[model samples]
Target: MWSLALLFGLVVCTLSVPTGRNSPAFAIEETAEWIRYEGYVAETHNVVTHDGYILEVHRIPYGRFQTASTAKRPVVFLMHGLMAASNCYILLGPQNSLAYNYADAGFDVWLGNARGNKLSRRHEELDPDNQKRDFFDFSFEEIGKYDVAQMIDYVLEYTGSEQLHYVGHSQGGTAFLVLASSLPEYNAKFASVNLLAGVGYQNYFPSLPLRTLARLTNTIYASAVALGLVEVAAPSFFRRGDDDSIINAVPEDEYLSELSTITELLRDGADDSDNSNMFGGAALKQIAHFGQNIRDKTFRRWDYGLLENRRVYGSVSPPVYDLSLITSNVTMHYTVSDVLLDERDVLAMVNDLPNARARKVAREDFSHLDFVAALDAKELLTDYIIESTVQIENLRSTGK
Candidate 1:
């Protein structure tokens, strides 16, 4: 439940779902086009995972004011959370968004779209909308296992860099832990990892109403999946649309300007003929995976129940994702008011992570959406994160 995105997404499901993943209207405006629209050199890269999910990645090779340089800029990969496409990072526009801010800071920025989103919906042998049920048979677990792993390798290989800085929000961070824990070798591939309200443990979800809702949603999705609800696509009511105005929780006093910016961005995207969804698409399993965590109160693997667990894990229960295995330099950002992530849960994750620390957002009222959507967020937090990554790179380059 991405409070900001999901809340509005629920209301804005009015943004008509395209019958297919690759509708002509859907494919026209991608993250790269958004990047180029801002007068930056944007490169679109199609990275195929081992499992054949072709991920759509956008790159800002240099800053808006600066041209490509002989000196190779350090690369920073920005991943979106569930129901969000990479566009979320840039939708706030230049100077205010993460993708643009990282570029303006001279680091090569890569915006990543996970499978099931509008951008990365293509798979080698599956049609997402043509009754290919297996196409939707994945959760964040598979996302971490295949999607994140392949994208990371592709970025490193393309840039000829040994490691890159990672900044992921919510399920984005969840996928990183999935990769690092499942494939421990990938631990060495990061200069640093930043999780914005990164969720791995949910023993103490702050909101009772939302948690109860999540439990019901989880059961509904899981039951549906078992009964051949594998292919979750259009004509579907359970869709996530990306209009942030669906966010009704932001504190009135603090977010007037930021909320205005959000509305304006919505208007710009709403052409008479084009009802582009702010969020792309995600599998029901993705929601189910998070619901499992909220229900089970652990940051472990998917709970396939008894029978499927035996077939999948050779046991009656799924294995846990060991945060201890994620040895990368990790920084977690949490807020007192982020109903999705409690401070206790964040600390538990911090304790479990072998090499990790935690940062609390000063705005105790910061919503989960504020981590990604608020313009004031960078000043409250991300600026320091950017500086820290830069310093780490400086130290590495100088062999300090």
Candidate 2:
């Protein structure tokens, strides 16, 4: 049994690529009305960063229909990835994605939108419409250092708690890493860290199509920046709700067709399908950034257009953050068939953290989207993570 468990961990690390080969075969059906997520109500609050950007916070109260106390229920503040809105967690709500599962497990879930997106756009005294350039002016550093830190402070203040468990996916994970490194003061604010296909180390694994696109686009972006085309941001193609299998009740045929488009590969060997399972347009841009990161073997400064648009004028470009700050005990979970992030890359990331734990999920033919959207994910993917996180939290509390 010990040997099998070790082998499975390695297998999960290997299949983090976007290829459909050797993916998981099971599908999970939704039988419950997601853990009491009331969706975004009219209640709006402001969280100001030390740097001066005001992030809009929307609280989705626990399902009043269910019996649960909001007092000290271990609040979880969720941060979305690049180009993704907090609604990213909404899709997972219908059938009890992590949002539902965690809430059902008795936690007050807080979904956060990074600055510059659709919902979180607001200025202290200025309007985002007049300051369109300020809207797009940021990189992962800003999100990690400014946005996340502010959110953490806000959650702690509102909940009257010192720390809350942190969960981030992809860029969300990157932001958390930055917080741990650049802002070590906030390290103690997290009870546990859960990284879903996050980026920390980017060696050992390669996605062909995406790498090709990054190489090509970086050239285009660099040239555009040089030639006064600094107003451009990465393309946004993938949008939320594109993958309804996890949220709405889409037919299997439609789901497969959409999945094929989103999971299709580009020329260099990465999944370059036109239809992304997440938010559209901007998502492709985010992927393009990841592709570039993989090719460059380093995190990058923010694009001028993004920097200027997001309204961070005269802001110093963030350097590639040191990864050693991510020394908190972290558990990484990946599937073998993920094309964007491969198992090799996952292992590389794990090696970078001084105190990191790793686990792999089975996807004999898993694709990148299968981690969240595979109909059977609740049984296969999420259950493992849910169980693992609970175990980690318990261990943290008990020193087990």
Which parts of model 2 have CA positions greater than 4 angstroms off? 1-44, 60-64, 67-71, 125-130, 222-292, 300-320, 392-400
On lDDT, the leading prediction is 1
lDDT of 1 by residue, 82-134 (tens): 76777777755676678888888889999888888778889998888784467
Candidate 1 lDDT at 258 equals: 35
User: Candidate 2, TM-score vs. the true structure?
Assistant: 0.69
lDDT of 2 by residue, 41-131 (tens): 2234678877667776655445434554545566677666554555455454444456666665656777776765555555575455555
Q: What C-alpha lDDT do the candidate models reach, one value each?
A: 0.73, 0.54
TM-score of every candidate: 0.83, 0.69
**RMSD for each of the candidates:** 8.5, 11.1
Which candidate number maximizes TM-score?
A: 1
Q: Residue 161: error of model 1 in Å?
A: 0.4
